[model samples]
Every structure is written in structure tokens, then in C-alpha cells.
Target: MKVSIFFKVLCVVSLIFLAGCTQGSAGTTVEDSVSLSMESETKVDETEKFNNDVDNNSEENGDNALKMLVNWKGLFYNPMVCSPYGCYEIMNRTDYTGNILYTDVVTRQRIFLSPDLSADHNNSSDPSWIDNTLGGCFLFTMDDTLFMSRYNYEDTPGELYCMDLDGRNRQSLVTFTDYNAPEGGIASDGQNLYMVLYKQDKQWLVRVHIDSGKIEPLKEMGGDAAFLTSAYGDTLVLKEIRAENTDSEDQMESYLSQIHTVYHYNITDGIETEILSWQQDKLLEEYSGEYLYLLDVDKESLKEVSLSTGEERMVIDALSAESINAEEIRSLYPIYDNHLIFDMGNDEGELKKMSVNLDNGRIFSIDPYTESLDAYGSQYLGIVGEFGDEFLVTSGTLEVPMDGIDPDGNPMVVDMVMSKLSVIKKEDFWNNRFDAMEPVEDVFLESMD
Candidate 1:
């Protein structure tokens, strides 16, 4: 609530400044002069000083310090759907014929394509439920072809469809009759597609050739499996049940209740590398290109492991334990320019971003808001999807100010303004253009709180 108040004041000042500059020559209004004076009076030299101190502190520590800027804002879309190559946005609105809309991020031009497949796989009683068919993970190949895994509850074997970028030629790659395809099953490497299938007793990770319908077992990890990360080139990371404890065995004595291990499988060589292991004592927070970062609850320290050498290092200790009363580490993610963003859970069970630090351990806080007081609890203000230098962040009570932007750009705000989607430029964030003044620091702080 305090953070919200700060944002409100900041917004009022910004609006007054913009109004005075625009209407000064037309007429000498008393309100305009007052607004200008108010803007000047609210300019806290201390705020700029604090920012300067942070910048200086970072520079003194290391030259590898990341320079961050908040550039543009728009609705956060899945990053995998964009970037490296390029991607088009697809929204499933419950209006009209339910067409798929595509837009180029660079040019901001809208490109319309015919619906490759109908949303109604099964003509259900509710039309809204029929539109659920559009929901699934999609990956575009280097050759500019779109591949998607569609789920059909009615049939035994669901479908994997491949279509031209413009939704032209369509073909079904493979259908699995024995095993149901998991959601977000397909991960591709331009040559082959990997799909995770959930069987009765064990989980199987299968690879299917894109060109041919040939399917083969990549690796079968016993127990439940959840998708974690993709190495982009050839490796896939999966979280699998390494060991399980049963009631027949001594449950109290056995330390291994449920251990989640991150395994890297090379699709090309068919090699499974046990890069990192997490037991009840240690937990993984996030992973970058070469490092797997974990939070040790028992030790109260942030740990990192090199994926190549299997060497572990303690980076930082959770010193401010009393101030936040954090019970567990909620979310750990990597930001652009190689910064680690971590969230900690408070006594109320709400999670907030605690710190943004580099691999070497220089830390900074972006606290601007108080944690929302709601019975249901607050959701994470995550950098859900990213592309190039930009990423999408969803925030607030209603997720009202959901926008995507490069945080390392000049002040430009792209106001989605409670619409289905809107674009905010870099200038808006820097200039404080929105009526809603959610400061970047405040956004981060609220997340941590």
C-alpha cells in the first residue's frame, strides 16, 4: 500500500509537468503554474543520489556489472514463442470466429493469417470450453515452420501438427495411442522434436523426427517428471523423481522423502548428465547457461554449481532473515544481461522478489511497494517471457498493468491500460508518463515483500 501511494504521487507530479509544458503558451492558467511548481518541489535529490550510489557501488565491485534500463511495455507473452529468430503473437479471444493474430515486434505491424486449426476439437456444450483447444506450447523451426501439440481428451492419440508460418500447408507428424502427451510436451532443435509422455508407472521422454514420423525413446526416467529448461542447441533439462519413500518403509528415518534431480540429456549423443542434485536439505532456485544456482535452507546461503565441472560454490548468505521472516525460497529466475532474480516466501505464504544480483554476488533491492493484503495471497510479479533485450512482467491486484518492455532502455511507458493488450515504449517508464505510477523499484520491492 505504501508503494502504491508513492506511485500515485509520482504519477500526479509527472502528469502536472507534462500538462504545464504542453499548455503554457496557450494561456496563463493558475493551475498550470501550480502544477509546474509542485513538480519541481517533489524532485527529491536523495532519490537520484541513492541511484548514483548503487551505480557507483556496482562499478567499484566489478566491471561486469549490468546496466539496466526500463525501455518498453506491453502484454507479457511466452518468450519461447518469440526471440533468437522472431515470433508472432497469438491471442485466443472469445469473440468472432476466433482467428489467430500475429504481429511483428520490431515493426509493430499486424499480420493476419487463416486459422490453421479450429479451436473446437470436440464440440463441447460450452463455446468457451471449445476455444480451449487453442491452448498449448508452440515452437517455430529455423525454416519458419510452426509446430504445435494439440490435446484431445476424446481420442486415444492426440496430435502434433506442423504448418507453414503463414498457416498454409498443414501436416500431422505423429499421434500417440498408448501414452497421453503432456502439456508443453514438445521441444525442438530444428531437426528433431522431443515430447514427454506420461505412462502408468513411469514417465518417458521421447524424441520424434520432424521430417519423418519416426519416434524413439530418448530416455525413460522412472517416477513423475516435470519440464524444467532447454539447452537450446541439443540438451534438455528435466526434473525427475530420483528416489521415493514409501509408507511400508520407515518414513521417519528415511531422509529421502522426495528428491528432485535436474538431468541434462543430449539429444544428439543420447547422453544423460546428472548436472545437479537437490535433496531435502538443498533446493534449486534457478539456472543460467553454465551454472545451476540453489538455495540451501539448512545453511541459509545461495549456492551455485558449474554444470561442466560439477563444482559447487556458496555465493551469498541470507543475512536479512529477521527483517523479512522468509520461510522458503519461492521463485528464482534469470533476467537479461545475466542478472539473477530471487523471490522469498514470508510467514503469510506470499512470495516476493528479494534481490537482483549478478553471478559474483553484488546485490540490489527494487522495493517500492508493500505486499498486497489479501486473503487469497499475492501472485509473483515475474519476468514471465523475454525476447531480445525485452521481457513481459505481469503484476498488480487484477494484473492490470501487464506490459512487456526492455528494462535497459530510455524512459518510455507503453500503457496497455486494461485492454486485452497494449504497447508501452521505453520513454514512458523513464518519463513517468502513465497515470499509474508503478516505479520499477517499487515493482521489485513489492515482489520481495
Candidate 2:
């Protein structure tokens, strides 16, 4: 059986997502707020239930406004998104059960965005993962509206939603009962939302009209595992992972050399323009600009390519002090706050994160475990979202040797579990301010054990 741990499996490049026509109105009554405040000093047993207070209404803009909708949120670990006011996260959800919380960054005041959505959680066979045959922030936003398609990986249906930033004027857009979308299969243009969805056997690029709430299928994705990365201007970047023959006797070695292709797919017409193609051995990252970044493990160089002009600039190489042992690099992510992040594996194949500063072309290591120990007494899993120069991340409470053991014996773990969602400023993190991270006290959806 293949198990996908929420943290290490999710990979993405950085984004400038919010791209949509400013249209749409918020409706519906302002729902009541149900607050479930946890005792920050108390420790709950693993079996103790955490309550969700989803008593109101709210929404997202269009889908494209998100830098990493499905990618940013660790949909399975700690689903979160940030707005100018603060950040909204699917909190207190464990085992696919939770509610949304809006926490003000400046005031730390909290509110609810949805009612207990535990019943709505898609508990598929693979309960904790998205069906990204390929995968972020799981929801996207337009000006003040939110759009989300809820689905898990198996043969489940997906329900689309549109809402306001405050959880008011929410709309149940549509439901893909016949198809479920991989989280990365979502994007937006002007006023429409685009998605990649598949049923039992095949995949296709689909579109959703914001005003009419219409579902439109535009193109077919071949049988290979495919998904979208982000959208820019009138085009969405599409990527596909194809199997390549490496002329090696070992099948596993061939699988390691996966082929990847990225294209600028125009939303106006069904046109696809090739941008770059490389093997899985390379890493790709580009932030808000018209440039695409790559960590060429094979060439032992870091390259910056202009999307419009196809100009490639060498940023790092074997001779540079930032030189990396290409074979040991596992994965790379999009630039966030001008820092290019990548994962490098140790001799035992354990992955650790490293950061590259584009301005200075200097390298720094991001030790999530040590960082977590300083803040949550847990292990940092992945990033949740970026809000006001700060980032909210998910960190797992250290697991007991035997999960079925009594959970009450560990108060420190319990406190960390309650506040598993931690927030740290991008500047603080870059400066290695691990102690500066503060935990958000959203309860778990289920037992951590």
C-alpha cells in the first residue's frame, strides 16, 4: 500500500495567483458564530473530541487569486489560507473533520467562517490526501470572494463553493459527482475558474463560470498523471509527469527519472505553448514575476528563465559557493518572498529543506524539526499559507512510540497539538527566528495518535 504523508509529498513553485475580473456579489444572511475555545493550559487525551464552530457564512474571490491554493494549505495536515485582514484556516479538523477560522494578525481576534463541516469532510479510502494524480492552498479567492472544490482521492464527488471573505454571501456553486479534481487541477481567469478533474479512468481540463455556475470541460489530459501549477495573465501553467525509459535495468531507477513538461495554456483559446521540459531530477520555482526558476540537478546549476523571452540566466553552479550535490537533492519549491527553497536528502534518504536568496545568491538551511522544537514541541511538516509577510505552517506533535498509548501522559505534546498551527514572519524565519513562531490554538480534528 502506498501512503502519502501530508508534509513531504506536497511540492510546488511560488505564486502571484489573484487574477480575476472583479465581479460577483455577496448574499445570504450573516450566520451566527460558534466559538470553541480550547484551554491552552489543559491537555486533552488523544480520544478527547475537539469541537468545530462553523456557524457563519463567507467566501473566496475567484480561484486564481491563490498563490498555492491546494499546495499551500497542506489540505490533509492543516488546510489554511490568508487574506489581508488575517488568515482563514480549516482548523480543528482531524481525520477529515474540521471548521474554518479567521484570525486577525494584529489583534489575534478570531471568528468562524463555516459551520461544523465535519459532515462535509470527504472521508474517502485515502482520507487524508487530495487526488492530485500529479497537487495547495485548497481554495482560491477573487477580490473578496472564495471558491473551493471539496473532494478526496477515491471515487468521491466534489462540491464547489463560493463565498465572501467573512463567510457571508456563500454559494454552493456545483458538485462534480461524476468526477473528482486533484487539488493542483484548479486555476482561474478573469471571472471563471478552471480545474483538472478525472473519474475512474481519465483526466480533463474543466472550467467553472462564476456568474452562471456552469461546468465546462475544455481539454483532455492524457492518461499520465497531470496537473496545473499556477496561472498568469490569460494563461494557466500546466504540467504533466510522464514515464521515461532510462535504459537502466532497474525499474526503480527508471521511475526516478520521471519526465516533466510545463506549458503556458491560454484561457482564451485552447492553445498550449511549451516553456520548458526537464526530468524529475530537476527542481522548478518562480514567484510573482515573468521568470521561471529551476534547480538543474543534472547540470549542477540553478537557472532563471524568462517566460516571455526564453532567456536563461545561470544563478548557481558547481563552482559557486552555493554548489549542491545534485544527486542528493530531492525536490524544489516555488520562490516565496524571493527565497528559493529545495529539499536535499541525506544518506538515509531523509529530506531537509534549504533556502537560496536570489538577491544575494547565498544558501541557508531551514531546519523544520529544530524550528518546531523551539516553537510547538513538534516536527514542522509544511507551510500552510503566507499572510501579511508572515507564514502559517503545520507542525506535527511528536508521535508516541505506540500511538494507541495513553495520550494524556504528554501535556507538552497536547499543548502543541492544540496549537499545531504555528505562525512566523517570513523575515523571522529567514533570519532563523525559530523562537519567534507563535502557535494558533485550533484543536485537532481527530486523534493525533
Candidate 3:
């Protein structure tokens, strides 16, 4: 009996990973080894996902135009190539700047919200190249008007600029004296805008009355780190990660070690309730009705936590018998109602799309890319957004020419990927078939330049 190429490669990868794991201390426990392995595996996945955004064409003079093929009004996503450290650089390593391009799904038109919003690279020797200051922006539409806040990490604390959808009627809304940075996550209730402000070990939930320009700090959320997950309808969800000092000798180092906890705060009732605590390095967030769903990528499972009782139950397991291909799911985005769209890729470099019924735990494998669209053949990175009974998705791959020179006169070719935006009817998607005659447009935006 002979081992297949796949198995051989898998074995080699495992061996090399184990060998690298031994570089730690000899007394490193099995738990630590497993944790390190999981972290390393996550990094490898991120690298692959990062690589999928490249465009392989060697010529740099091609026309980079986008198309408009959909007229569905809903929340469309401007896909950004981001990493664990910060925004992923395209073109070259020296190019640390990246911008998000938003599309008005209703008008089938693209919107350029900000020009100078970018990530600053902190000079860190770590292989991950963690970003000290990631680009921060709060973008959302309310009452037919778009409101955005562009905050530069390099600027002073209280420098947030607000603007409209057409880049007109811009004004400075807030300037910080010495608060922690705005997480760049914001939510609005048609009347007021909400944001999470943090300064070392403290978090504050605040809202700015859009018309009056009155800013009020609502609550002091105590955590080493906090994220404003979602703000919609009447409820807001926040995920807080706490740092506890394990080493009494060095109190500062103890705070470096942390655990995660989630909470739900109701704007109507003015009540903040603790929901669930996470064990793994993953963070789960998605609010639906009376429950908030939790997704753990490392565990390949999704759980639903009750907002009232603080109880949780596993809903879907990507590695279990019910999943499509039983493959690890990545980039799970929630559509309207109790539906979730996720990406699935295999070792053979094949990308797939899967949707799960959050209410029933049923999974459907879909191929909305049936219409002679540009797939790049290797991988399909799809971004699914909801609009009524239809979905607006942008699918494509990253390509690297494998030959080029860096700006600093060094030999380097960077990864560049394009997005092909299209619209799919909800019924058509669940039927496992896409109509070829339908409008399948390519989204072009000036921000990619």
C-alpha cells in the first residue's frame, strides 16, 4: 500500500510543525503544545486567505475597471484585505496603506467615503508584523443619509471627522483629549450614533446625537479590551476580553494574559447583561432576536447564547457529520433572518460557498458563480451581503505575478486581487442553481488604486 500525495504532504507538514513546536521549553505541557499548534495553523490559514486576494497578471497597465450588475438595496460590504496585525498590504510590503470601497446597492453605484484613511505600520521585529495603529472608521447609513467617522491612528485622540454618502457636508464631530482609541466600530439608531471608546483597561459606550452634535458617554465598560460587535434595531452587543495578572511578581505581565467574555446591552431598557465566556482564542458574535450566536473558528462550531438566561447551545459544527464536505468554514457572514453564509476551501485549492439555516441547522452548498464570471480558477473569495430576498456577493481571487521589483529597488512582486460583484436571488441560491441570464456585474472602485 502506498500513501497518497495528499497524505504525504499532510504528514510532512505535521512533522515540520511538530519539529518547530519543540523550540519551546522542554517542560512545555501538551496543552501548551496544542495551543501553539492551533495558533500556528490559524496563521497559515490567514496567510492563504491573504494570498487569495492577488491578481496574477504580470503587466501593471491593465484597465482595472469595475462593473455594476445589481440593484438590490441592503447592507453591501466593501471587502478589505486585513490581517491579525493590521490591514494587509497590497502591491508591496512597503505599501502599508489599504482603503475600503463601498457600493450603493440600491443605485448599483460605488461610493468613495474616505481618501486618506490608512493603516500605519509599527516597526516590530515579530514575523506577524502587528500594526500598532489600524485604520479606524465608523460607517453606517440612517434615514437615507450616510454618516461616517474617519479617525486617524497617528493623530491626536479627539480627531474624528464625519461626512455623508457623497463625501459632502463633512464636519469634525469629536476630538479626544486622552481616551483609549475608538475601536472604529459604530452603530446607529436613526437618531443617535453609538461608539465604543477605550483607554487602557477601561471601555466606555457613548452616543453622539447626529443633529445636535452632542456626545455623551453612556456607560463605563471595564475590560482590558472591548469591541463593539453590532448595533442595530434596539440592541447592542459588546465583547470584552479581560486581562488578569497571573504572575503576582510582575503585575503588568499578569495583565498581559487575558480571557474573553461577551455581554448584551439594551438601549431601551438601559440594562447590560453578561452573556457567555469563551475558552478558545476565538470570539463569537451575531445578534438574532433573543439570542446572539457565537462562532468559534478554532473549534469549528457555532453556538447560540440566550440573552435572558445566559445559556448557550452548539448549533452547527463544520467538522461534524452535517456540514458540507465536513470542511473548516471561514469568513462566516450573516444574511437576513437566521441564515449564515460561509466560505469553505480544501487542501486542493478549491473554494466553495455554503449557507446554513440558523433556525434548523441545515446546510446547503451553493455555486452562485455559475455565470461565466472570473473565478481565477484557483480560489473563490466571496463576500455575501443581504438585500431583501436577494444577496449581493463579490467573488474573486488574489494573484501575484511572481516577478517584480519593490519600490526600494528590491526584487519583490506583490499580491493583487479584484472583486466581481453580482446579485443572486435568495430562492435561486437555495435551489443550488444560479441563472446565467441574470445581471452579474463587476464592481470597479477607485479606492483600490
- The most accurate candidate by lDDT is 2
Estimate the TM-score of every prediction: 0.59, 0.67, 0.55
lDDT of each: 0.40, 0.50, 0.44
> Please, what are the lDDT tens digits per residue for candidate 1 over residues 247-271?
4377654555667777777666888
* Candidate 2 whole-model C-alpha lDDT, 0 to 1: 0.50
Q: Model 2, 52-124: lDDT tens per residue?
A: 1010011123444322233311243224445433455443222234344554433333334433323332333
Instruction: Quote the positional error of residue 330 for candidate 2 in Å.
Output: 1.7
- Which 10 residues in a row give candidate 2 its minimum summed lDDT? 49-58
Error of 3 at 106 (Å): 5.5
Q: After superposing candidate 2 on the true structure, give the runs of residues whose Cα lies further than 4 Å from its correct spot.
A: 1-78, 92-97, 109-111, 114-138, 152-156, 245-250, 253-257, 282-289, 349-351, 368-378, 381-383, 393-423, 438-449
Poorest stretch of ten by lDDT in candidate 3: 9-18
- Flag regions of model 1 displaced more than 4 Å: 1-80, 84-90, 93-98, 107-143, 184-186, 226-228, 232-234, 248-256, 311-314, 318-326, 365-377, 394-449
Candidate 2 vs. true structure, TM-score: 0.67
**Backbone clashes in each candidate structure, one number apiece?**
29, 37, 15
Query: Which candidate has the highest TM-score of all?
Result: 2
**Selected candidate, larger TM-score, 1 vs 3:** 1
